[model samples]
Target: MERMEHTSNADLRAAADTVLARLVGDVSGTARLREDQWRAIEALVADRRRALVVQRTGWGKSAVYFVATSLLRAQGSGPTVIVSPLLALMRNQVEAAARAGIHARTINSSNTEEWEDVQDEIAAGAVDVLLVSPERLNNPDFRDQVLPRLAAATGLLVVDEAHCISDWGHDFRPDYRRLRTMLADLPPGVPVLATTATANARVTADVAEQLGTGGSSDALVLRGPLDRDSLSLGVLRLSDAAHRMAWLAEHLDELPGSGIIYTLTVAAAEEVTAFLRQRGHTVASYTGKTENADRQQAEEDLLANKVKALVATSALGMGFDKPDLGFVVHLGSPSSPIAYYQQVGRAGRGVEHAEVLLLPGKEDEAIWEYFASLAFPSEELVRRTLDILAHAEKPLSLPALEPLVELRRSRLESMLKVLDVDGAVKRVKGGWIATGQPWTYDAERYAWVARQRKAEQRAMREYASTTDCRMEFLQRQLDDEAAKPCGRCDNCAGPRFTADMSEEALDAARVDLGRAGVDVEPRRMWPTGLPAIGVDLKGRLPAGEQAAPGRALGRLSDIGWGNRLRPMLAAQAPDGPVPDDVAKAVVGVLADWAKGPGGWAGGVQDPQPRPVGVVIVASRTRPQLIHSLGARIAEVGRLPLLGAVEYTGEVYPGPRSNSAQRLKALDGALTVPPALASALAEAQGPVLLVDDYTETGWTLAVAARMLRRSGAQGVLPLVLAVQG
Candidate 1:
């Protein structure tokens, strides 16, 4: 087989056209590559060049790579290695490749059992394309052994969702920077292609520079207008979550076809799913918590249109393709307009018209702030981490480091990935180790990045409230030179959606959101490596000391009551008596608990005992609120109000991100007062232990242990909200 580099331009064009028709399932020569698509392919295959393609969604970005892989493999090129970002995207690409007679195999978190077989196929030249996730690029064995061989033999390199390679991109991942090394190691003359639909000018320039690695400093960048004529974009602003949900219930059926309903958090997704199901709508919840098999099933259900919509989070954003997906409805605004664009772009791909709507919520900003707090740790935290690793005797796994650090597991791993890329640390077989490299914190750059995020958030707010063309607003956000009004949008053609909801729908939504009580599952096991932090605790907590399964009025992430509960539990909110409505809601929750499954009414094997008293957990920030809730419940249930458990020590000053650190701070801070102990001894029945809210549940666990040990029959914990 000869290299196509010397092929005539006309011959290259004709060959690409044949592959394009086959890829699109049009065998009668009715389908051809767009001029820009052909140019991208020609540059990659004929000229052996690196190229960055910034095209709109549904603009045949995948086609460019599939067609190029077909042409390159025919010329005896090694199997094309694509560094894809999402499992969904990889699955879609694999199927699409097979349609063009390209044997594509994926190695992702979901397909570990098939990795060796896939590798064997690649080695035997039976596989024409191999798709690996960005995270896979950093796996110890894969990085140390497999990547080098794959790089040397690769004919073409493709980075799907390439915007993620840029720090400026909306969905940047630290693992993406590892691509620079992969690109640098590629054999000379290996053509590379990067594609995304959501990059702006800044992200585009950054990605182009990244693609220029390994001496290809003049990478070709092909960007196109981002306007989508098939989309009818609109924003329907209602008063609160209930109204927005009511609007959804009233209008979901009216949307063009089967599609997605995006929520900001997993709790919201599940809540929406449950409520929509109760209303007889065919919907399923898809989130990070969903099992892999369930996610796959949900995706299949959506593709087959077995369900009307999938209530999902950003977890379902990338790699999903349903050509006839008729709509995409966002229940809450995403923090960045760029991310919103990528999500809404899922619709209107193959159809003449599709509906895209945003039902922005007031709780959206709070959710945004919560995620923002998890960004790159401060310089102090990073320095401390480096010092700990510098003095370590061996590679430390993430759990081993958790007790020594203040960051959560996800944030900590993400930081390690960045540090690994920055040469300050290295990920080895066991875990992470310090490289002893001279590393300076990029304070200025991080500050600029923070500012950029805030600006993007503000832009998203404007997008929701702006009177201008919605499509044009998104286009300009991507820095498209051809941004213009799409006359199909609600703004351009006048409002196509009404904010008004039927009274019946509104009442039903209120009933759903108004009903409270999410189970507060007890923490069964203590965090790992607690001894490293001077704590002797480890392994599963004793059943005798564990609190009975508790209940919260709602979650801070709940779409129904989150808006009402968030403020009442906020650190800055004025602490006062529990409002009458809230007090009544608590009573209702108790009544339901007394009668629901596993309640004291004897529905389960061993039903809980009715509370003989109410006990308050001391709250430094909201003692009045806690006391009021306990007193109200005690009065309503005709039970005694036991004395409050008191705080005996100063506030434990530590980051509250992970369970271990949280437990460490709470270890000795709480104590059962003598009066409370006496009251508990006399009560002789399960007591309703109360608090304003529970975040980690460790505090509740600690308090419940003290109560149970002090002779309380059992601790039935209740709280205003669950922050997890």
Candidate 2:
């Protein structure tokens, strides 16, 4: 690489002009690069130095990499490798690269079939930029077969949404840590760039240190003020979820242009989207659960202005580009101000002014706490996972390992990636293998990370209730030295929105939210490798023993009744009798459940007999709630109240383990009392099994099986709330 001092200023100026012209056509016009953008481009292309650019959204961060790639490719360098985080963002980057006459391609989860073709293009020197997801870096085949060649031949490397590489980042992804290995493998003088709009001083330092680009002081860090001049921020404290949904239905069209409405959960997004559509708004729902095809269509529709807005979760955040987005409304507050600022930055990129509002709900903090529980695993769990893999005779796939370990599938996958990066495990063609490398759990580091999360949560609460300027508060949270009141927020200016909702709208929202019942489909097959846990069950369960399809009053994660049931079912809440309203709601669900297609009245090939009696499942935690709910249902339906199923063993509660372990714990925990067996023997129809809450549904399945064997015609599992 040539030193910057040796290059003449005239040549550098001429090269920058050409790159700018490619970036924006008709360069003869006032289409020149900002000083910071030029500096970043010079560092990466001419000086051959690593750079970290922490500019706000729409500050031309992407332009620096695209232009640099164009210049580098002209000099016969290999294709630029960009690590992006979202599919929507990748699509937009591909299109933007095309406008500059650069050939770009992406290899992500959605396009595995195209990986071979992309590799061919790269080898043939026909590709200028190649985009990939962070998760792909840890994939066994890609890591072993493709990463080495790409790293050795890459011209420029870019990490978009680079904040995720830091543990202190609001959205940390373990897979991003794999970059450490890639960075080390790169040849000398290969320029690297990382860009994010949401990182504060701490996150910036952390990411820069991880980049390890000739040490932190040598790496060029260009961080600008974290403020969007076009966004007018505000917060409205809504009474509850219903009021929030009603407000959106009432005021969605009053905002500037088509934009995004972000929700904290997928269920809330779907509910809000449905309610808005009922009120005559053309919108779509976007979440992690959405299929790839549908997500693509939703993005295209939003970009084309075919819809008014997209009701989405954080799944739609980061890298989505739409210059003319008009507004951003949060149905619920995010856990961190950095995350909030990132989502709100999506608006007012091209336009002069846009609306950004946060409708804080009472349940927001609870939702935040629930997500906080999914952080990195404990030392014991990690050790257990490693021990399992080490003792196995052969490599263990994720499912096979799930039975031996207690972590859920998603969390387990994330932990494995972290271990793989730490050299404790290796992912091969068959499965994961223990490397037997000595590793120490970083207790102090994890504790610090936990404390940081709590502080971020506190900052978010402050952001919601602060009387200061919203933008200034958010900027200060990111450690922006230039933080100052924007003079446009609700605090600086007067209130921009009102909480007053008409009775008709409120009534409509209540009806929509109150109409609750979610089908709880029974588990039809036993988890694989059950015999390894000393359980006899395996393969498909017999049809005769399967529980009938069940119903729940609502999901614990829903936007409507969830708010009502969460507190009552909270781990800390005192156990008591079922509330009158909830009991009434259960009756409503039963009434609707009886009329559905597969209900007792439905004309099916095998019609189920109506439940003749009600049986309560004994609960150690919420015995009163379960017993009261069952007794009320029996009283209302005029049915016999059968004796309760006794929990004969120690109070195992419910599934805190994987399927195999949970089934093992619940195999013979329940027993039919003599009176209950006698009552079931004389029953003429199916019986309803009641419980307080259902999480894994293994408890319900076991109890239903016991009831069926005791001579009940069939068993119907009913619960107050179902875990999402």
Candidate 3:
């Protein structure tokens, strides 16, 4: 360390003072920490206990973890271990730490020898912080070789994205289950500092439980609001893949500096990138299959301004932070809103106003449903796993244990990790050993109950399918209320959404549907034979001429039951009664109400039939119709249901995903009987029918089919907040 002259110390002190004051500031501006951040810092200062932070993207989360490392250095030399899921993120934080004058090191495959050398500093207690991936932290060699060293060198255990410990965390990296073991191996008194950008109340509780964060978790665990005003929220009624691609092409020049386009599939990433490049845009593609060296180069070019945009997936998360990013576009529906926020957060890092465009594809929701399907754990499977854990004398190897567990090879692998999080077993060596404990029904059962997660899946689908303000959902996720509409998004700017579409549009015209959480008006009521529009199935979005036989509807059929709500031409009506295959799947739901999709004839006193919330993109409604719907809702309904209704008749040029208008419409149309509202608050049922217009009927068909889950009984009852 260089000795400082009086002048140098004073200058350094002045800079330090600015940081110190900002550390505890009340309202954090863009690129700055808010009172929530300062509160977290203050809590860390107070007897430093375990802290789990659930914040939204762009809330200056990195600054919180970085400041903690700063504190360690200020108190004199002490090592800090940060277990990150993303290699890029780990690398970035390591570089950031170095820049901040903190000695930071990382153990990753990028530099094997250099990684080995880090052990020396750690062993000598000279390294101030060590960034690692859990895959490394969980390795026997690393645990054996470096953990003892960690005990001597570190002052705190900093687990970034602590929410990963919970299955519900935005991006679940199954390996996160072993965090407790990582914590156990650390020095005895090192407090756990857990932080994440996406985690709700249940997630926070789950984090505390998994990390063994007790009061000894000491009070450092904090939750920050997931709010950002710099982002303009937009949603639109997109026609087809060609239109989406065209829109993307049109918006290329709108992006400044670096931008990332998120795709639901690997193929989509390549296609979008190639299309953009052909259109004369400086674009690159990054995905799991991308070579590591190539990916790094792509990242460098993006940051160095050699490339204007990159087409990627969640693969871009963790360590890739180019503070000057212009925007993040989703070429298809994201798996979850949390994922959407994380992906979009990559943009506006410098707190610059940014656009988050989500161009939904027909198959987007189905793609995720297939992946998220693995979320549910079976009782038979659970028992088989417990048996294996009970029998294993040593850590079981995958090859060795595969025969004993009756599950897909992949399922068993993931389940064992989830079991580990429940503390049902411990993974050791190539196998896992029993924890020598009796398991309670709730603990073992709820741990794998995937039905409780169905609504979350709905929320994700809603984000993509609903023509409402995308930002409001993001803010609400963080417990922040959206008071007004954000003007910059597609829904707000879309043309058809103007006040003159119809009488209901006039009533609901005051609110921006994008910001409304309610579902928009149904497209089914259009007079017979609306002109049929066509799209190229092979074509991408926002491109190609608009014409064909309700072609977009064919694509919509691919997204599951949610697709039925998509905008369609008045000329195109179902040639026959909509299919009942999906309805048969949930016949109990259709039997309850006589009204066209959402009539509640079942009374509140009746056992909660699976509840379904219908979000309708409605046109104008007479006051009499609104009162009629309210009166019907007040009657005990077979299914406890709520409708998010909107009245914006014609869609604008933007994605009509804004729900503000619909929410208002629903509020005006549906007044809960005080008793019905209370009953809904306490209602327990599966998410039975989440649907709107069903011409092809595939979207609703699929949703009705998925309502049989055991945990599906817990979907939160939907409520209409306002009228359009």
TM-scores, in order shown? 0.98, 0.97, 0.61
Give a tens-digit lDDT track for model 2, residues 1-724.
Answer: 1123334545765666666676666556446778898899889877789999999999989989998888777766788999999988899888888877889999999899999999999998888999989999999899988999999989999999999998888999989999998999999989999999999888998899898752756689999988889999999998878888888888888998899999988988988899999999999999999998999999999999999999999999998899999999998889998999999999999999999999988878889988988899999999999998999899999988887777888889889988898999998888999999999899898899899989989998899889999999999999999999999999999898999887788899999999889888888888887787778988887777778999998888888988899999998899999999999999999888887776776736566788899999988888889899999999998888897988876666465757777887877778999999999999978998998888888888888878888898888999999977
Relative to the true structure, candidate 1 reaches a TM of 0.98
lDDT of 3 by residue, 424-522 (tens): 776666667778666554555355435535666678777665566656666565444332445555555553221112333222212211111222222
Off by over 4 Å in 1: 1-5, 213-217, 602-604, 652-655
Residue 553 error, candidate 2, Å: 0.8
Give candidate 3's whole-model lDDT: 0.54
Per-candidate Cα lDDT values, in order, are 0.89, 0.88, 0.54
In candidate 3, stretches whose alpha carbon ends up further than 4 angstroms from where it belongs are 1-38, 109-112, 182-189, 212-218, 385-396, 403-410, 421-425, 430-449, 464-469, 481-724
Error of 3 at 648 (Å): 59
CA lDDT for candidate 2: 0.88
What lDDT tens digits, residue by residue, belong to model 1 across residues 1-724? 2345557878888988988887888969778888999999998988889988888899999999888888898788898999988888888888888778888998888889999998898889898889999999999999999999999999999999998987777898999999989888998899999999999998888888877832355568888999888899999889988898888887899998899999999999988898889888999999999998999999999999999999999999888999999999999999998999999999999999999999999999999998888789999999999999999999999999988998889999999999999999999999999999999999998888899999999999999999999999999888889988899888999988888788998899899999888899988899999999988899998898889998999988887778898877776799899999999998999898988887887557578888899889877777788888899999999999998878876764333888999988877878899888998888889898898888888888888989999988899999989995
Give the Cα error of residue 178 in candidate 1, in Å: 0.8
Clashing pairs in 1: 89-319
Compute the lDDT for candidate 1.
0.89
**Which candidate leads in lDDT?**
1
